[model samples]
Target chain A: MTDTEPRKESVSCPMDFILRMLMGPWTTYILYNLKTHGPQRFGELKRRVAGISAKMLTERLRTLEGAGLLRRDYEATIPPKVTYSLTKRGHELDGVLGSLAEVGARWEAEDAAARSQRAAESKSAELRAAE
Target chain B: MTDTEPRKESVSCPMDFILRMLMGPWTTYILYNLKTHGPQRFGELKRRVAGISAKMLTERLRTLEGAGLLRRDYEATIPPKVTYSLTKRGHELDGVLGSLAEVGARWEAEDAAARSQRAAESKSAELRAAE
Candidate 1:
């Protein structure tokens, strides 16, 4: 929809809907991990995500599944194996994820460089004060 | 950095860094609004964003400014005009935002279609029961 269209105060606006989908904590990260590493078991995903509580992971997974973004496969094996992977629809986020990564890398590097420069400047100022 | 590279437990990872930047509430919305509408004074922006409180808008605007993603221009006058626009760094998010909008619009349309079909199916089932 064009911007000229009267903006709705609800998620009916395309941008608003997508933002709500992706805005949850650890949502995009979960998608990225699955996309990059392929299907993963619950434990494996939790480890890969790092710092995500088991409960949070389960909740996010269910949300994604409910939205039809990912698939959950079940196996009635010895330990009852279950795996999560991006569905065809979830994979559709490849471009958006890629862009985020590329831009993130670039910005992160720039921020680091700026930090280093600031540190060096402060150190020199300290030296000048001592003299 | 390649995913094969060992992941850090911090925002050093490219995806993590960018996600942290964008994951805040109403952040992308604010950026999207600025990009589409060009420079806008604070009052106009508060209106266009829809449902954003003046306090939240001010906070998000400050955060964006702090990150160097947007510029705030001030005109010293009776009303104290202040305009906000995306900086070069913020403009870099154009591709990311565009992808989200496209994906969101497509999904929204699909969702609408699915809802309609479900309604039709339920109606048919009800008619069958009546017969």
Candidate 2:
């Protein structure tokens, strides 16, 4: 039982590896942006993924590229332009991200409801204490 | 626009923070086990979550407890026994986790199909090169 937790060194189970790759803070946002908006340059991706930093976005892009999930194209010019888009392999993950997005929406609703309930309960508790 | 990234300090968007909370490698597994198996002891949790070690499991449990996602009940006995289960807030996350699990299954199937397709294409290319 090698249960002591291994490093993220090339996950052996293919699907697990793939899922973990997209498990980053900005991963789903980035992937969804690519799927919905098509190919985008580096700064375009940064803008679309909400809270991603330049360094983190760059690191994430490199990881995705290394894992064969995305393809990068560079155009030669005075200032080089780099564009990234999903590869065939990455496109396969869209269905997965789609499913997650649906769940995320539900969680948003439920969490809101829970917070309201708590607020109500808190107010009642305060009234009782005052009485 | 605060273009610079902030640390994961106190996630502002409740959903974003919560999602990030459950985004750890072994998180879903731990929660799923709790949902399916009901409240269990520390050792049981350790066994159920495939790759979690004692130290990491302790850390995660403490984090979840601190976040109000789980409740810890300690039975005062000859030896200590600690049991953990989901809070109402954590139960609310079930819908989200369920959605993710469905997507995870889809990704598994798609990865298999894609690998087969690639293997076939590679063989075809090899044969063409030989010719």
Candidate 3:
């Protein structure tokens, strides 16, 4: 049986391959940006992702492209316009990213409600103490 | 607007939170194992996840539990039985994980076919060279 050690090649199962793809730093973020905002130039992606270094972002983008998860279109202009977008294979991740967004949104709301409830309880306790 | 820089507190959106959760090393594997195999003991989980240290596995489990994504059950026995499983909230990730698996399986199949084609091409080239 192939245990779950992450191997770059000869991957035994699809789950392992996908996990490795998703776990790379800023990988999903890049994918999410492309999926949500559509194709973007290199600079736009950098600004949108926030805090990702130029070198790091470039590396991530290249890696994704190598994995066939994204496409890089280069226009030879004065500065060489480069736009990145998801490939058909890459777009298959739409369902997964969307579901994650749904869950994340729900959890954020629940956490907010819990925080408000805690604040209310603390305020009531302060009032009781004063009384 | 909240850009995609990871913040531990006051997360601005569901997608960011979900991205953070999924990007953690061995996080998805743990979740996938639990989702696929149902509940498992700590030892079983460690073995199944492959290459995860006991300390790291414990930490991942604790974090997931704290986030209300999984549950830990303890049995009072001589050996102190402990089992881990996804919570109702954790189970919500079913769609995301399932979709990822689907994509992975398809990619894996395509990759295998490509590899075989390349090998066949190489063999034919060698035959031509010999002739």
Measured by DockQ, the strongest candidate is 3
Model 2 chain B TM at 0.79
How big an interface RMSD has model 1?
2.4
The per-prediction i-RMS, to one decimal, reads: 2.4, 5.0, 2.7
Q: What is the per-residue lDDT of model 1 for residues B1-131, given as tens digits with 9 covering 90 to 100?
A: 47753544562346665666676677877887788789999999988888789999999999889988999999999979999999999999888878888998898889999999999999999999999
Report the C-alpha lDDT of model 2 over B31-54, residue by residue, as the tens digit: 777888899899999977756789
- What candidate 1 gets wrong by more than 4 Å, as runs, is A1-12, A116-131, B1-8
Question: Candidate 3 at A30: error in angstroms?
Answer: 2.2
Please name the candidate that would achieve the greatest lDDT relative to the true structure: 1
User: Is 2 or 3 the stronger prediction by TM-score?
Assistant: 3
Q: Compared with the true structure, what per-residue lDDT tens digits does model 2 show for residues A35-100?
A: 888999999988767667999999889888987778999999768999999998788666545545
For model 2 the local lDDT of residue A75 reads 95
lDDT of 1 by residue, A50-130 (tens): 888999999999999998999999999999999999998899888887888899788888999999999999999999999
lDDT of 2 at A49: 73
lDDT of 3 by residue, A1-131 (tens): 38854352442345656766766667777887888799999999999887779999999999899889999999999989999999998888777777777878888889999999999999999999999
Predicted complex 2: DockQ: 0.22
Interface DockQ per candidate: 0.44, 0.22, 0.51
* Local distance difference test values of all predictions, in order: 0.83, 0.73, 0.82
lDDT of 3 at B13: 39
